[model samples]
Structures are given as C-alpha cells and as structure tokens.
Target: MTVQSKQGAYHTGTYRNLLLEFGYSEEEIQRRVLDNWTQIFEGGEDTRIYYESEDGLGYLEDTGNHDARTEGMSYGMMMAVQMDRQDVFDRIWGWSKKYMYMTEGENAGYFAWSCQLNGTRNANGPAPDGEEYYALALFFASHRWGDRTEEPYNYSEQARKLLHDCVHKGENNDGPPMWEPTNKLIKFVPALDFTDPSYHLPHFYELFAEWANPEDRAFWKEAAAASRAYLPTTCHPETGLAPEYSFYDGSPNHFHGFGHFFSDSYRVAANLGLEAHWYGLSDDLVQIADNIQKFFEDKDPEDYRRYTIAGEPFEEQCLHPVGLIATNAMASLAVPDSPRARAAVELFWNTPVRTGDRRYYDNCLYMFSILALSGNYRIWMPKN
Candidate 1:
C-alpha cells in the first residue's frame, strides 16, 4: 500500500485490493478511475462558481433552477475536503456560503436553489433539499477543518438549528415530521417525497452527535436507519426502482406509475457519481447498490432504449448512462479495500464535472475513491 505522505490521509494498498476483487490489476482499476475523472471533469473548474469556465458559466446562466448550482457547490466543498487541497478548498468554500445561503427568504429563511449571476441575491424558489444541502455542507466543513469554534463553520450552527426547526421542530407547533410540512406552517407548503428510502446520509448523525442534544442521537439515527432500510424492502422487485414517494410509516406512498425515471434510469450513472465508499456496506445500502447495479449492468440494450418518466412523456435513447454512472461510481470509490473501491489519490488527475468549484466535488469524488481503493487494492499494486 502507498504510505500516507504528509499530504494525504489516503493509502495505496486499499486500491490494490479493490481492483483484485474485481478481477483486474490494481493498475487497471486505477487506470479506469483516472480515466473517468479526467473525462468527466474535462471542462470542469475550481472557481468561486464551479460550473463556470474561463469562457463562461455552465449552470449559473439562470437555468431557471438553482438546484444544480447549489448542489454543485456542496459537491465542490466536499471535493476540497477530500483532496486536502486547502487553497482551492478555502476560496470556493467562502464563495458558496456567502452567496447561496438562504438565511432570509420569503419562505421560513430557506436556502435559495438558484443565485443571481451578479452574486447579490437568489434567483428565486426554494428546493425541498436546498437548505438541507447547505446544512450538510456547513456541518461537514466544520468537521473537516477541525475547528469547533470558527468563523467559516459558524454557518453550521445556524444551519443545524434550521433543520431542527424544519425537520424536527413540530414541538413549536402542529406540523408533519421533519420530512415535509405545510409551507404556511412556515412559508411555502411544498409537498415532499417522503418515501424512496436510502437513509445512510453522509454526516447526518455525526452532526447530530456533534452539535445536537445527546439524547437526540439515537433518535436521528433511528429515523435515518428506518428510512434507508425501507428501500430494500418496499421498492419494486423487477426494476428495483423505488417509488417517488414513501410514507412516514415506510409504506409505498406514491400513486402507481409515480416512480421517477432517475431511480432506475439515472441510477446506474449516478452510482458512478457517488462520492461515498462502497464497502462496510450496510446490509440495506449494499442491497440498494447491488440492486441498482444489477438493473443497469445486466439489462439488455433493448430494455435500456428510450424510456419515459412516470408522468412525463419525454423519451431519448440511452447513451451508456454516463452522467448517472459517474454518480454511482463515486459511491464505489468511497469504500476502501472493497470489491468496488477506487483510489482516493486519483482525484488530482481524475477531474470532476464540477470544475470551477473543482475543490468541492472533485475532492469529494477523490475522498471516497481513494479511501476505499487504498484499503483493498493493495495486492496488485502494493506500496504501504
């Protein structure tokens, strides 16, 4: 295994082992990962606005929604932490929190899904998950920087309090569980997709444990655990596709034909995009990943061709499901010494779709990949 240098927390042996399990040389797996990184992040950037390149911005041009831009920021921050690219990480980190945070909005101080190009105010409309993303990022960034009481991470404290209010604070008034509440309860009564499982959210509990009341740890863990477990049990068998909406009771919530194409269609590619490890797989998550992989890798080309969303009729031919594939692949990279792990160090060369905020997403993708691949893929490319 490659020994941890002063620069990296990642080791080399892990990647070697992971590749061997996949029945390939460590170099081959490393090669594949490196290739994917370079290709996907081809025109990617590491600027204050990640999607933008030297010539112009990608998603920042008012794509009508800030979902991609906001999420992209989170991805960039995450990548920065993983790569240990302190300089790249810090600048983008500051840029995002300053512009994208939705601390004061028409909606109960929700995070804006889109930001204006001028960098002054949000474009409009809040996404169901936007605030959650901000909170998640702040909490993780605080943890990554190893600073409990710092200026930058100060965002985390407020972010968490908001989540508690929105997701958990029915105590203040009558409302639904943290999942979804009437907007009037606060502002914008957006219906939520309650079901669809996969609760193993990154750093949720750690944050709860770190910042929330101690008594609340198990509660948060249980809630998340139950949600994640629901997927393997309640999802469709043939497609392993989860329904768009799940119930508070873990029952199938959405109406028939309500499943999102992203579940099955985007899943394959999304798996590749995952920035988490694939190992130490919880029985449920492993099953979810396995089920998703089976559908994609095993499906015939005929089955893969032109598909429609549950409600929409748009159709297009599948072109290897690259976008979603990278997402999923990112997950596999997270777990070191796994049958699926990728090397974390490869991020330097792998590149990410999130270029301008390069440190954010790129670092994240590398973090998981290097961690998992190093622990397992040691046999073929031993160094440590």
Candidate 2:
C-alpha cells in the first residue's frame, strides 16, 4: 500500500506545529487535546456538548436551541475521524442518516439542515456547508478505515454520491445545485444566488479535485482556484473582514441584512489559515490575516463586537468571541511572523473551551483551532 504524497506548492516539512513551536511539551499537547475532546464529547457534567440516545444514536446539539443541525453533526464526524474515534464518527453518522437525510422529494440525496432530537425533521431543506463537510469527512473516513459493504457505511461511494448531487442536482430536475454551475462557487444554500464567504474552502476543494469522481475533477479544481481568488475580493482591503454573504462578483450582498463581519464570517480567517498550511497558498492570505489581527489587536477581547467590513464596530456585542479568538489564532498558522498572530495564539491558549448555552459554535471552532495549530487536523489519503 502506498500513501499519497503532498501535491501542492507547500513543503510538508515547513508546516507549523504551533504547539511544539510554542514550546509545549509533547505530553502537554496530548493531554490538552484529549482533555478538550473529553469535555466536548464525553464529560458527564453540564459542559458536555454531545448526547447519545438509548438506541445508540449520538448528536451534538446547540444548547441555545434544542434542534440538531447538520453543521454540528458533520463537524463532529470530522473531529472524530481526525481523532481516530470511529465509534463517535459512526454514531453521529448513523443519527444523521436516520434523522437528517431526505431520501425522497426534491432533496433526495441531501441531508436536512436541522432536526429534532427524536429523529424528526425540523427543515427539509439542506445547507450546502453541511453537505461539503459531510463529503470530506466521509472521504477521510473511507481512507482512514476501510469501507463496509453497508449502505451508509460505504464511505467513498456515499461521498461521491453527495458530491455528484451537489453539482448535478438541478440537471435531473431534483433540485437546485448547491453550487452555481457557471461560476463553480458554493451558494449559501441551494436556492440562494449568493454565497457565504466563509463557505469557500479552497483547501477542501483542492482535495475534492483529486478524490471526487473523475468526470467532476476539473470542476473541483476550478472551484479551488475560484474560491482562492474570490476571498481577497470579498474581504475588506484594510480590515480584512469579509461579509457573511456576497454576490458572485465578491461584493457584499445585503439582501438579508448579512453584509457585515459577524458570526459566520469568523471562519474566513480559519479557512484561509488551513488552506495556506495545507497547500502553501499563502501569498495573499498572509497579508489578509495580518490585517485582521492588526485591526483587532487594540480592541479588548471583552469588548469584541460585530463590525462593518470597513472596521466600524456595531452597537451590538459579539456572540462568539471565543470563536473569533480561536479562528484568529488558527490564522497564525498562515502568518507566522505577525505579532498579532502570536498574541492571538497566546490569548487562545489562556481561554478555555466555552461552556454554557452558546458553547456549541465556540467549542467547535476551539477544537478545530486546537487541531490545526497542533498539526493534528490533516488530510488522510487512502493507501493503495
């Protein structure tokens, strides 16, 4: 069996293992990663974010809302796979397939965006972000652990099917495609004409180009380049804050009052950081991360709030300061020399995984930041 080597411009040897680079002992890194995962997925106290049903199904819930979201479930799957916890991955996948998948109707191959804990659908519509994560997680699972003969357990096939549907849904009159066919950009949702800036994950798209069905490989490649080029346009030239939603031309779309740097836009830095680390595409992203970190360097974390792309703070407070901090720290992976990058990492090191009603998003970003910084979040290729 041969493992695939890195194909991008970045040399693997230069990748920053931030924990080790920051003087963390190997033991300390292991302990912290495990401790964080345990608190999130296994803790018995109120801080535990995941719950398992009597029937063996498991889910990560947004405590603020009683509903289950595909975002959390797919994220749980990715985390579990990266941590080599197949049990956790399978449980979440089972719960998702049982409850969230829409097997019939316009969205047959797509998973529903939200559901009740008892396996009831809260919305039949699918979210494109969930589908993208689900596909990537499934592909990684297939590579890390050999696929089974079962339906949902057939990881590679399931991933291929999902990707096929993502790009081809409208072709068969099943539903609108998650991505715009002409531009190859991911939409906020299948029916939406605009996109979430944070949703353009070029790193994941790069891998998709290599692993997705042969017929669609070129499209995914174009998508990776399109997203890489689109990011700088969406982000502000000075502050580097991206809007939550934007048009195909990369201009902020204010149709739904989402034209500001808010909760969803926080992932832009994290995404750019990871993409740069994985593919060595740091030329433009480094400056962007620097600008973002510098913009927030003087602002107190306690006072972190929503802001216009131009850097004007909103009167409303931030909903996920921890998430913002985590992502900013993750961005440090792309911009290793920035003082603001170091400060962001230091602040994240001192902060604990959020616990309480709003901990879901914060903790998810926290875990990803932990994985990315420590060099644990990685691409798992199949051995052949």
Candidate 3:
C-alpha cells in the first residue's frame, strides 16, 4: 500500500500497481490492459471508437452522438501516448489540427469542442477540460517520443503555446481566458464564468508548472494548489458527490441545470484517484475518496443514477454506469487500505469495457481505470 507520507510518483518515479497488490498476476494485468485498448481502438464497428481518415489522420467518434468531440480526441491522444503508440498519437493530433483547431476567431488557439463526422464544426466554443487534456497529453508525447520539426508534431512547443493561450486568452481583450486570473480556477468553457469540478486535474497542473512556458510557470504552480484546495469544497461532505458545474467559491451553480451529479461529475472520483496516485494523497483528498467509495460500496452498478450532492437519487438512470464503476475503482488509488476500495477494484476488474452507442465515454474511463490500477498510466517526464 502507498503511504500518504511518501513522495509522489513525480518525485520518486515509482508508482504503485494496486491490481498487483490485490493479488492479480502480472501477465493477467498486462493482457487486460492491452485487451481494453484493442477493444476501444481496433475492435468491430460496435466496439471501436477510433477511425482512420483517408488523409492518414485519425479521430475518435462519440458514437452515441454521431460526432467527434475534443473530449474524445484529447482522451485518445492521452491514451495513445501512455501506451507508447506514437503513430496513433500523431494521427490523432494531425486530425485535431486540421479539423478542430480554431483560428482567426474569438476562440483562436483553441480546438472546437465538437464536430460532425465529416469534420464540420458542431460548435465553435472551446471546452476547458479538452484544452487541459490536450496540453498535458502533448507534453507527455513530447517526452515519450520526442518532438519533431513538423507543425503539430512539435509536441512540446504546441503544448506550451496552448497552455499560454489557456491562461492569457483575453489579455489583449480578444476573448475570455479559460481560467479566471484572480482565483486560478478553470472555467467550464472559455466563455463561461463557472467551473466543472471534474475538470480540476491538479496533478496535470503540477507538471504544467514545470513544463509550461517559463513566464507562466508560477501561475501553473498556484493553480495546482488552488485546485487541491478547491476540490474538497465542491465535494459533498458526506457522500463526496460533486456537481457537474459550480461557482468560483465552489457552490453548485444551478443556473445551467448541470449543478447536480451526473455524467461529467463521474470523473471527479477518477480525478481524485489519479491525482493522489501521481502526486501523493492529502487528508482531505483521502476523505473525499473514502466517502465516495463508502457511498457506492453497496449500490448495484445497474442502479447507478443521477443524484443530488447530498446523495438523493433521481428517477433518471445513469447514462454510463460502467464509467461510474471505473471511477469508483480508480478512487482506490487514494484509499487503498479501505475495504470499500478493494471492493471497487474487484468489481472493476471483473467488468468489461462498455459497448454500443454510448461506449465512447464509458470505455475511455474504463481504459483509464484499468491502466491506473495496473500502474500502466504513468508520468512520461523528459529525460534530463
């Protein structure tokens, strides 16, 4: 078990394989990880989300929506880099540059949040969560495979410039920044005033502080701390459920009607686990994970549903129950010693990647959870 007092993977270059700790064999873990990736990226029509374009680029489609999204694209890139699939990474990045990258608009330097299957824009605005993931995935790609002189292949430079634009978008009054300058909290979108708790990935920000443009390093550092402090506020004290959207002060923002726990909120548990695994756990963070695991320990996966932060269930069924299971399994990274944590990992290990119309999001979370538990999701730092 990982001791909370020990250094994080960032400092020590050592990661805990929780699946191994639970007595799973190394070969089984390896096979499970590979199988999950294959199912999502190369399986049959109903299974795979990735598609190779005629131009040699690739894109991951949101099968349920019949469109491609920056969310899936960025996630595919992250998975590709983590799996050491440089070909897939470059293909996805190239596709993103050609189809999603915005230019000569209020959203310049940002990727379009959604696009049709034919590469037409579905929306022109940017999602902060996608931008953050793209930046971090690019950085990891640069470290793992080294950057190239080509346009989008110059991964490090691309990541730095994107990060610069994220925090400085409105400096010349062009548009709103993704993050609020005063509070250091990332807004849900560039034009939005509120934030999504699931978008708060402090572990990524910590690395951004060290690898982002030198001028913006301090802001990234402060942003990391701010997020760590901010997360607990968004979580329900008893259930650890977070709203999909919230104000800068961490209060749920009901204006957008996404102020309840739902699909987006499912990422909160996974985020907390990954953050603790990469950067070590804190008391508050541990309690948040503990509460989440405890709340779900006895609940049937089939019964997962929309809920209030106070744990009140709605009549609506959860769209991605497997995603919820995967995230709860991931939360074990923070509270590995808890009995609830073990139950989560066991449940997740036995569950298969989701298939059908809504497979994209569920499978992505499933892959991440498996990689994380198997210690395959790692920090790809540049060799100094």
Candidate 4:
C-alpha cells in the first residue's frame, strides 16, 4: 500500500486472495492470479490497472492502496494469485519484500500500515491491527507459497508471536489481536473499531493448523473453531442467510452498526464467492448464505438485529442485494452450465455500478466487499 502524496503519483500492490477464488473455475482462478503477478514488483511488470491504473493507486485515491500491512498486502496478493493474476502477484510480492520487517524490532514480523506511495517503510510504525492481518495472511501465504523464507517471514516464528505476543484472547478465544505491550493494551487508535477482520482470522488459523507443531496445530485449531463458534454458527436451511454482528458475551455492541449491510454483504459475498473449501477450517460460504437467509426470512419489517448493550434493537434492513456472490458461488460449484449462473454473475457485475445500490454504510465497505469479491479474477467474464 502507498501513502497519499501531492507532488508525484505512485502505486503499491498486494496479492492476497480475499475470497480464495470465487465464481471462476479453479483453472481460471489460477490463470488470472498468475497473469497479474507483476504489479507487486517495483518496475518489472506487464499491463494491468494493477501495474498502471489511471484512477491512481496507493493512498492517492481508491485503487486499494490503503492497509499495506503484511496481512493486508499479503492477503490481497495471495488472492491476486488466486484470481490468476500472476503478473500482479509477482509485482506485489517482489516489491513487498523490500518493505517487509525481518529485523528483531519490537514489531518485527509484523508490518506497518502504510509505506511510500512508491516504496516500503519510508513512513512510520504499523497500526496495532497489524497482528490480526499478519496472522491471517501468513496462514494463506504459507499454504499458497510454502516458502516462508520467500516472504521474509518464518511461519513458525511468526505464528509463535501471533499466539503468544500478538493475540489478545478472551472468553471466546477470538478477539482483536494484541498490539505493542508498550501500549499496555489500552491504546485508543487500534482499539477494536468497526473494521473488517472477522472471517479472515478463522480461515488463517485453520490453514496454519495443517502445518503447525502439534501444540501449535491445536492452538490454531482452537482459534479457528472458536471463531466459527462465535459467528453465525447457524444458517438458514432454505435461503441460507443470517445476521452479522460483533458480540460481547453473546450480546450485541452496535457501535459500528448491528448486522450492518457491509458486514452482511461480506457474509453474502464470502459464501457465494469463497475460493477455497476445507472441512473444519474455512467456514462454508454456502452454508453461511443459507443460514443468513434463514435469519432474516420470517422476520417482520420491524424486526431488527441490534446491540444489546443499550437494551434496544435498531430497526434496519439490508437495502442491497449483493446476493450475487451467493448465487455465483452456487453456480461455480454446482451449476456451472446453468443460465442462472451467468445471470447471477451478471447481476453481481452490474450491481451497484450499472444496477445501483439499494443500501450502503460507507463507500469504503461498498468498494471493499465488491473488490474482495472480484479478487478471484473470474476469467470467464469478458475482462478476464
């Protein structure tokens, strides 16, 4: 990721596969992920908006230059590979190593939030949220690349830090990752906000558990299991949708917004568009959709999901039908030949842009969920 600069324009790239490769056939996902691998590189690259985008990249504008931490960048980069954009993957990976932290600084192995629009940490310290993403990305990177040395991170050491030093476990064993003890866990800047880190953590650790020490494996397993348990553990048997919320003591805290559309959209997006499927590891996107649909199906218009902290439910309903992800996921997995599959993809493709959004919380999430959904790089579509 890059910082906003007024004098000159620059861009940075990452290759994390946000959804593991949804919608496209596996071969298609591989093709795009491989094709766009060069944007991660400093100079050597092919042609793609990733390498050269007119809209601007980095912090200059909305070309996804924010959240350049290892987890964020790595996750995006990995997903780029999943999208079959190897050019983007290679470019992002090639350049990211220069900015990566390997020294034994207090925050070593973790990463800073932003770097130069052109290069690495010519900037400052990473956001405390780094641990959360680093852990998440590490899981996928190791699985995808199998070379920790290549990424400037030792999976063993990094996982150790995430479990013992970086994570802040709670009653559910799932909470915001710990930042510097120097902050004594009270710093306000990184205190859990309404940020999006929910589904990733589970996917991360589940992959780690596959290659970890027996003890480490167990730890990652527990963490993954806890995350699954903490989420919408139940899905609709029919439509497969459910509520989205951050809970404290199994109750809601709506500071961000209860079952907010963005998070809800993500669940829809992830399930309908998830790239990978591992039993007991990554949560099932299809099942999640069905349950979410169930969660809201029979409820009345006045029905609402809210933070119980205030002892009240705010009346709200999702105004957008990002369910195209869900429909696409089903299509790619089960009904590849069906007309509805193409229609579902078309609905998602035209949605919000050509179709117009029915609801939105912030344009950031609107962009985030859509882009993350597209990270798979479905080549069957015209652009791919």
**Best prediction by TM-score:** 3
Window of ten residues with lowest summed lDDT in model 1: 375-384
Candidate 4, residues 1-384: lDDT per residue as tens digits?
A: 121222111011233332343345555544533433332222222221234322232221113343244434554454453444444544555445455543444444445556654554644444533454445444444445443464334543454555554443332433334422222221212335322223334544555565444555666666655545543332223434333444322233345454433333344335333323222123354344444333443433234333122223345433433432333333232222344434444444443321222212122222333444444322121111
User: Least lDDT summed over 10 consecutive residues: which range in candidate 4?
Assistant: 3-12
Q: Model 2 segments beyond 4 Å from truth? A: 1-15
Tens digits of per-residue lDDT, candidate 2, 1-384, equal 121235233446455687788777878887888899998899855567789988998998977788789999999999999999999999999999988998898888899999988888989999888999999999999999989999789999999989998998989788899989998899998887999999999889888898899999999999987887888889999999999999989899987789999999999999878876677654666678888888888989899998999999989999999899999999887787677778889899899998878888999999999988888888888878
- Model 1 lDDT tens row, 31-127: 6545443433333333223344232323323222333455555555454454444444455445555655555434444445566655555454454
Which model, 1 or 3, shows the larger lDDT?
Answer: 3
TM-score of 3: 0.98
Q: Candidate 4 has what TM-score?
A: 0.50
* Residue 354 alpha-carbon offset, candidate 4, angstroms: 9.0
| Candidate 3: segments with Cα more than 4 A from true spot | 1-6
lDDT of 3 by residue, 1-384 (tens): 233655567767888899999999999999999988999999988789999988899999999998889999999999999999999999999999999999978999999999987889999998989999999999999999898998989999999999999999899988889999989999998787889999999899989999999999999999998988999899999999999999988899887578899999999999989987888878888899999998888789999989999999999999999999999999999899998999999999988888899999999999899989999899999977
C-alpha RMSD for every candidate: 9.0, 3.4, 1.7, 12.4
Better of 1 and 2 by TM-score: 2
> Candidates 2 and 3: which is better by lDDT?
3
